[model samples]
Target chain A: MTATLAIGPYNQSERPALEESFNAHVVADPSEAAGMDPAARSTIKAIAYKGHLPFGGAEMDLFPNLGLVANYGVGYDAIDVDAANARNIRVTNTPDVLNDDVADLAIAMWISQGREMRQAEAWVRDGKWASDGAYRLNRKVSGGKVGIMGMGRIGRDIADRLAAFKTDVHYHARSEKQTPGWTYHADPVALANAVDFLFVALVGGSATEKYVSKEVIAALGKDGVVINISRGSTIDEDALLDALEIGAIAGAGLDVFVGEPDLNPRFLALDNVVLQPHQGSGTVETRAAMAKLQRDNVAAHLAGGDLLTPVN
Target chain B: MTATLAIGPYNQSERPALEESFNAHVVADPSEAAGMDPAARSTIKAIAYKGHLPFGGAEMDLFPNLGLVANYGVGYDAIDVDAANARNIRVTNTPDVLNDDVADLAIAMWISQGREMRQAEAWVRDGKWASDGAYRLNRKVSGGKVGIMGMGRIGRDIADRLAAFKTDVHYHARSEKQTPGWTYHADPVALANAVDFLFVALVGGSATEKYVSKEVIAALGKDGVVINISRGSTIDEDALLDALEIGAIAGAGLDVFVGEPDLNPRFLALDNVVLQPHQGSGTVETRAAMAKLQRDNVAAHLAGGDLLTPVN
Candidate 1:
């Protein structure tokens, strides 16, 4: 009688909660739905999914009775929303709950890049501090101009944190929004030109694919650094790598990358960049909250009520 | 005739300015004074001092005509002010110039420790994210209560930055001063007990030696963390190392340490701490500002005008 199908990898805490709450049929991935009995697969009214693999119209055909896809993370780029809309299926994502964690990571990377936290740690741990007199001085971060590529919830949160550090906030969005004395640029290149740091926080999907193009990255001068907590596809990967390699841009503080967890090998060799493993929202508290929100959406769908955070 | 003697290590930029401004005689250490001709040592009226080696009453007595000790850094714990006062020797420190950089390091460490930034970076670089799955989740940092163990310029700066992150700020100072709705605790132990994080920004000197006593560190329960960007004398090293070893507290984000550059071997072994090589005020812009300030003080002293930032 189970109507819920929990797909993709779930943490220890999440697995138990998913099993107990929904009497869910669990699988490691979306493709494994084919392995389920024909009768059971058709019974799935809602799916609790977490991963970056695609969920398109063909995948939706596997579940004839599928009504909702409740994603466990904030970004639902993996879920083809147009496909879901065409199939009359609802989509829900866990947002706002993860804004603080992502924003914290963005700010952390920004400061770490300027202060050289990784190299500093390595110097201390490897006994270089004892052998060498003092670590080399790097650039100062505070009292600089910063541009946020997106002025969404997560972008605004990062801007607020940087504002405390006395950075001048500028941004480029589709249109101007009300803000406290922050400059807005309609063109991404102009926004990049205006600031010493360009932080990418745009949404994922085709319309915004390669949104941070070569021109935008090139506009950031040799002293400029880029920090990205958004999707990898939002950036022109080759352009970024080229810029980082040749010192076209000063550096990058990246939590996401193209084809990640198997990112560009060039990134591994670079010393100028601060690379994080796409952990913008990877906090115990925030993850649990996201899981709960996803489950709540499934419960609401099963109960024939409206989805809590509906995308379509 | 050269009236100034530049002591300890000076970066390339600082060295030329120090030499040009005062026609200063240079020595690697104060002990090298013994090697100088007696007449030259006696004629040194001002010393542009750097490094953490003590400038006690005995060291002060070496340069018989010494009138001022212009320190390169803000924390003048290395200079024996009481001894300077006894000899009518003035002391000047480059203060306020490096506060933002120090405060930024404190916040950077605070966020880095919580986010497991070191591990996250390693996960990507080592190809573990592809081999294994996602990096393990860590605790959230923002929207929590944070405590400041001092209310000095740097302490206030750190609190202001944390406030923008939506953290409830609580502080310990000699007495409460004007703050933006931050709760004050007169007792250091109470401050430790009240918040999830305690940032030590106390000044260094015998008066505040081991100010963050064993009792105060013990008060921070298992979930609490400590961040120190101040002088190494503020905390008992043995107590901190012991607590870290036994997991008495969660972790520490430390920049300064006792006998730093030659820190306790125990700190290198501990995985719970984010160890930095005492680079709190080591940014290029800030360091240049500090060097300029120190040189300005020396120039003023030589000209028989008011010292820029005199201590005694």
Candidate 2:
């Protein structure tokens, strides 16, 4: 039997599980696979993948026996699904398993930004609290109007958590969901205008690219805050940067940014924003679950069983 | 009729309301009242008070006609309630009005600490994410065991919010209340042992001093996070500092501190902790509501009517 290929940088703690599950041929990137002998490459039947590097038809053509691409995270925008479908190559992504973790992070970021927690922490750390008496008052998060873009599984989870805080939840989706009492707006701008806080929870793809446009951001008004736990491509980075620079919006809590890890340097200069690395689903338990789900999909595919969570 | 003394530094925006409501005599501090004529001081009957300064019989004695001490915040720890009761002076505090804000902070702190948001933010801001790839995985907050130190109004609010996040809510209170599904432990240490996150929401005072003791801190074990939204006196800061310094516990999210603004400098050195200035109830909406309630109490007392939300 051919070995399964495990791609991306898996830390010491996580790599063992992959090694135990399969006769794994680990590579840092797809290009590295080219260095291997043709016979070994031909033997690759499955790939356990992580990271945001684009893996398209070109990479797919490398392995003639490739049957499965088990993605290690919920969002698999990096995987060219259309190309995989054309080749009858199955692609499975870890989804619902990471919903709670991502939702938790979105809610945390919203509350943290609203409460000005970062600045408040600095006030205490710098000993300004003692000399200054009380820190300046911040905006209240509870009872505020909140708008969620894309009412998917993770979006619903974020809404559920916000509802507990007594927020009036509003959302913009392809179609109105079955959630009662939550106001639905067809236009994203209308949703933005109605909310003091707008959370981006749309899926990552060209269809949703720049969905949170300049008009939508401007509609949020001066006191409004934007929170993004979704893919960075869902927002227009230039518009967001401009708005944040001039204080057009109150602040933002961003976990994802366009070309993140190498996001726009301008974001680093803003004190009004709370910047987080793309870590919405970065938790030990969630990541472990994701890795397990990814591995399980590969195992099932090799056994000629049904793919667990097929994206294609 | 004498004027009501509005103490503490009320900003221009808030001062107008106090002036409009009372024949107001504004003073920066209690000692500043000494500059006033005896007639003016003797005629003062009500105080619209803010700040952490202790207000006892001695201060009350300055104004022979003093009948009401209207506190502008929820916690009345600094006000000598027994002395007020003995002097037949009515004491009122702003409560319930700030419950959501304080509870929001407590919940936010819990999630922030568990998710390691502060460090995550730094990873993005400091350009470590681009250089170091993905930030390290953090502990999941949802579905974790949570402990509330006191089951007061704020504690109940915290529990209600945590329940929505799927947390197994555990608490230590004076006695069990009517809360269903939540596990209550009579001993604080037992409660600490049962939870991954412990929140301090007890009332402030000597009676509850060091309520979260060294034993409770140790019982929390490793991977435990302490979140304090209550008074700093509720926890043994020395024990907490020791635990944080030695990695005895995972981390802490603290809003209040012992001698805050001048808190133990050791906290600033620790990267694992998220320190916030005492601003749990410091939101514009809540503070405005608190000020209104405080003024309402003073107005009621002046009219020989019932004091609103009276402590004594």
Best by TM-score: 1
What tens-digit string does per-residue lDDT give for candidate 1 at A1-312?
A: 689999989989999999999999889997897688889989999999899999999888899999999998888999999999999999999989999999999998999999999999999999999998689999899889999998999999999999999999999999998999999999999999999999999999888899999999999989989999999999998999999999999999999988988899999889989999988999999999999999999999999998899888
- DockQ, structure candidate 1: 0.90
Per-model tally of clashing residue pairs: 0, 1
Write one digit per residue (lDDT tens) for candidate 2, span A42-160.
Answer: 99899999888888898888889999999888889989999999888999999999988898888888888888998888788777888876788888999999999999999999999
RMSD list, candidates in order: 1.1, 1.5
TM-score of each: 0.98, 0.97
RMSD of 1: 1.1
Residue A197 shift from truth in candidate 1, angstroms: 1.0
Lowest lDDT block of 10, candidate 2 chain A:
A1-10
Q: What lDDT score is found at residue A203 in candidate 1?
A: 95
Docking class of 1: high
Locate the minimum summed-lDDT window of 10 residues in model 2 chain B. B1-10
Top of the candidates by DockQ: 1
Q: After superposition, how far is residue A19 of candidate 2 from its true place, in Å?
A: 1.8
lDDT of 2 by residue, B175-236 (tens): 99899779989999999999989989999998999989999999999888999988889999
Q: How many clashes show up in model 2? A: 1
Kindly list the per-residue Cα lDDT of model 1 for residues B1-312, writing each as its tens digit.
Answer: 689999989989989988888899888888886678888989899999998988889998888999999999989999999999999999999989999999999998999999999988998898999999799999899999899998999999999999999999999999998999999999999999899899999999998889999998899978889999998889988998888899999999999989888999998888889999999999999999999999999999889999989887
